[model samples]
Target: MIPAAAWGYQISSYPGTGGIWLRRAAVPHTGVVMPDDTDPANGPTSGSASSEAQRRTELGAFLRLRRERTTPEDAGISRGTRRRTPGLRREEVAQLSGVGVAWYTWLEQGRRINPSVQVLDAIARTLRLDRTERDHLYRLADIPGVPLDVSATQPQPPEHQTILDALIPLPATIVTARYDVLAFNDAYAALDPGLALLPAADRNVLWHLFTAEEHLQPLVEWEREVSFMVAQLRAESGRRLGDPHWTGFIRQFSETNGRFAEIWARHEVASSVTRRKSFWTVDGDEISVIATGFAMASTPDTKMWIYTPDDARSQRLLGLLVGRYQELGPAELLRRGARTGGAGRSSAH
Candidate 1:
């Protein structure tokens, strides 16, 4: 919630985020790396990883912001006559939280140190953080619970598929923390090749952005959307620290997609959010969609994305796209694709 989990809350052609993340984006990787997860999901890595560094930086900023907002009187501390600091002092926060002053100072400086859960709890108490703030703190600290609701990551519950289909004209999909498309409706497939039309292996938001040959053509705000997407990935990495899935995913693209590799090196982090985006249809139609993200309390490993048109014109355009897909249907489209020997490639083919 604090790292802007609803996401610095944004916009694009689509808003089917789980908040608006992948579906509506026009193109390019956001170049954000999940932070401070060098611990590796199974084992720990050096504290020097870029993502970890970025997480630490965010943690420090969050702490400082909270600290600044809290006053001495608010913390039940006596305001001495000669007070100069606007809020409680660093030592005061450290002392109240039962942590070392130097350590807290380093934490604020964004140093490469791990803050335990207990310590974070104490700090949270000292800062009087609310539930959302507390969650954001834990995430930035790279604590294990940051991923939230770690359950079965695959073959999403049947009900979820039903929900996506029900969304109708809206494009929607379910995505993993790492941006893998778990499930999507026909509307989502209508958006692009990777949303649902592509083979399961290529059904990843990051993968499509990085490897799709014609990605640049569809994306209008390549830099902004790409940066936000990467930031989301970076924030999520904090939770999957040692998971091989994340490790392999990053490594594979780093080697296969040069631009992705370059952007991944940036190690950016962002909170999950909802927003609008615009994309160029294969027929050269420009459609703006609102992307919204919803959390699945039933499972933390997955999220739902729903995309709505941003205006009447886009709505009509979406209906047209949906009508085309409905007329042929995914199966018919697939069959046609196979006949043309372009089944797994982009529909634009």
Candidate 2:
């Protein structure tokens, strides 16, 4: 329901009839739209505020334009010649982007549409947009193109890398607050073979735990572990509503993991980080380990992860993973908490 106050109502509902007659009204589009000047009370009048509305209006137009620019051949549809339109048909775009034809129509008609980054990205991909074009599309839609906390979304800073190396024999790794595996010692890679095979972006621990069903499930203590992971991702996601990367990740996972989708939909957020977590290895060895996450002094996204064993058996397990460790230089230590690395590393795991 539109806000009653926006419609100049002292109290909601009609005084006598109790019918929601003048709750807030939306005037039809008129000539010329500007930004931030329209009477928001009148419900989207044709003035400057309409400019924002126009920008939204252009989202539909731009989507349609993008649709019209591509050919049937570009989208792998058959062309019998004697064509009229310059681009693919509305149906073609709907089919290609995995959206409903009616829904796409409503979108192109500019009906208060706010698409998730993943949906917009799918449309962008269907239109064969490059990075710059994709970025521009996001700007026009008034949504973030990438994660807002880019610093928090990245791998380790240089100083953190040194810390990871120093924790070498202990099988230490560096990850972002969101569970991105930024860097790891040789020992960590040896202990977790899957870590070595993943692309840098897929090194995100949360992505693996959430999306890679086969890889993590066997090792996970489902009742508590899964719940904890879900809670952690839930909290991180809340902190990044406008972040493009997080938006895309959530959409993808929501489709793939129904349980995760359900939990995320509840709007639960948990920042609880305990000092310890226990796990059983594939070899039937139960390891009691300490899990610590330190906030980056400079870069909020990056942190050093050190796994210290609580017992001799776990310490022996660490020895089997890597050799002796060494401390990093002073310069490497200085870059520890700052956002380092580049853009290519920011994609969803």
Candidate 3:
């Protein structure tokens, strides 16, 4: 049986084997093998042969798309003659990807071949695949994908809360390594209702920036913020490439968000968690929020997000939203950030 936590799965018994294999024939990305030793002969059953076929078909589409997007110029091949297609030919791709023409053809044809990690990595690099795409490539091959360490940090010791409180009127929050909003005083919530309404699955800032339209569309500078978030997560993923949770999250989100899917295909890996970001206060106000990362005393994946308005204008606007320092306008009651933590970012495996 596949783990319940796994998504997009159904059970089917193999011909002779007592157990089942998670054969994904439709959407290759989610098709994972939940192999059972008892039944090996039933032609690799997972839900039904259709699911496996669907998966294979999707894999073919992904490979073809990758191939079509890359050009001779991208592969450093001379475009001496007029080309019949927009991108590099299959032969050029095979050459640039460092795989034999026949092998690449078989892969594009959806033939059964277990691609190695090294080869897949090379192909991803050659195709200029971003972190998400690289993760997808691995998934299509049915390789055990990277995991994410989504463990919540231990509760902040009283001293830590005191530190957060000492920050005073300044908005501050303690977050887990996965960006879980662990703890924040009223000050933090006093600034942004959206922050308080941060979705349970969006504790990770990157995931929220990429997947949550409500959280992101409101941002005055959506593209810049989302790009930076992607770069930062890409950097983090690099450090923990073998983590399954992170990999799965990347995959699920890519499948859902077209914008994220496009950007992730670029294969740009970077980290800028400490960069500055500007936010618009709810009361038609604007302010700059600079991020600073602080390590936890004892907990892993725990850090703090501090928001200091650039000036009094932003401060007043924030107060109006949270109803804490009612100066700009009447105070309004807003839900505080979730007291209990929620799930961390998804893996892209």
Candidate 4:
């Protein structure tokens, strides 16, 4: 289903023929017919037939434009000197997408055939469509649902970084809908110093929880935490069905982590909410905390998570850790933590 935010409500209903949805408000008839109304040279007949014909014409034009803009290399095809066209040929697209050349040609011509979502997905992949382009393709092909906003992946502004830094003793980090760890404060780094050192590709919270045993060792209820995180990812996936990055991430992560694959296959989904958590410190002492997540006002697709101590003992322990980290700094703390062979190696987002 399309998210209410991504699509305008002006569309009335699907034509059920893989054609564009009909608008709720009709265009005025404006009965003044042009002199060329019946002239085959001008185009198809006018009125409702003309509207449907025009939509097909526009669909064909849209497909052509996207096709022309795409390059052979972009679709993983080797460039050849014989090719006169700017982009992929219809047969080349059909071959790459695993469809019949004639059918693909008809689709580009806006024929009456209705394409299944699976077929449209194949075509979208072949064209190297991004999230927005894929959504536009779906709409042109009369597929339902809204695309996830891509702006979520844009670099966060400096103010966001400042906000994270200001969180201070409390561990705080900003994450995208895909759970990419975009930014983190010193307190958060203190919580898991090794995380800040990890390569950007390995910074995803779920990826760490599932694949990195060292990071998982500190969590009190490992299975429960992992299951909840998987459910949250599943929920996000529903809203971004055909997105290449989202789909590719899932495929790669699943291939690396069998446990995540099993849980993901269950198709469970859950909304985000505050939860109490416990992590073991280097001294083997439990640090109970509450983790709260909130959507950012400036970027709805981004979220901020803050961890606060849940009890007096936990609070003192957190304060002590933060104070020591401030005094020693990240490098010294990491060096000491490494030599001690303690929970300092454990990391989180």
Highest TM-score: give the candidate number. Answer: 4
Clashing pairs in 4: none
For model 4, the local distance difference test gives: 0.70
Q: Write the per-residue lDDT of candidate 3 for residues 196-308, one digit (tens) a residue.
A: 56644455555555554342223557687777667666777776564556777778878988888888787787654576666644333456667677777555445777777
Native-referenced Cα lDDT, model 2: 0.59
- TM-scores of the models, in the given order? 0.52, 0.48, 0.47, 0.58
* Alpha-carbon RMSD to native, per candidate: 19.2, 14.7, 19.8, 12.5
- Give the number of colliding residue pairs in candidate 3: 48
Candidate ordering by TM-score (highest first): 4, 1, 2, 3
RMSD of 3: 19.8
Q: Which has the higher TM-score value, candidate number 1 or candidate number 3?
A: 1
Comparing 1 and 4 by lDDT, which wins? 4
Query: Of the candidates shown, which would achieve the greatest lDDT relative to the real structure?
Result: 4
Against the true structure, candidate 2 reaches a TM-score of 0.48
**What tens-digit string does per-residue lDDT give for candidate 4 at 204-250?**
77776666546334576678888888899899888767656678789
Task: Please give the TM-score that candidate 4 achieves against the real structure.
Answer: 0.58
> Which run of 10 residues does model 3 get worst, by summed lDDT?
340-349
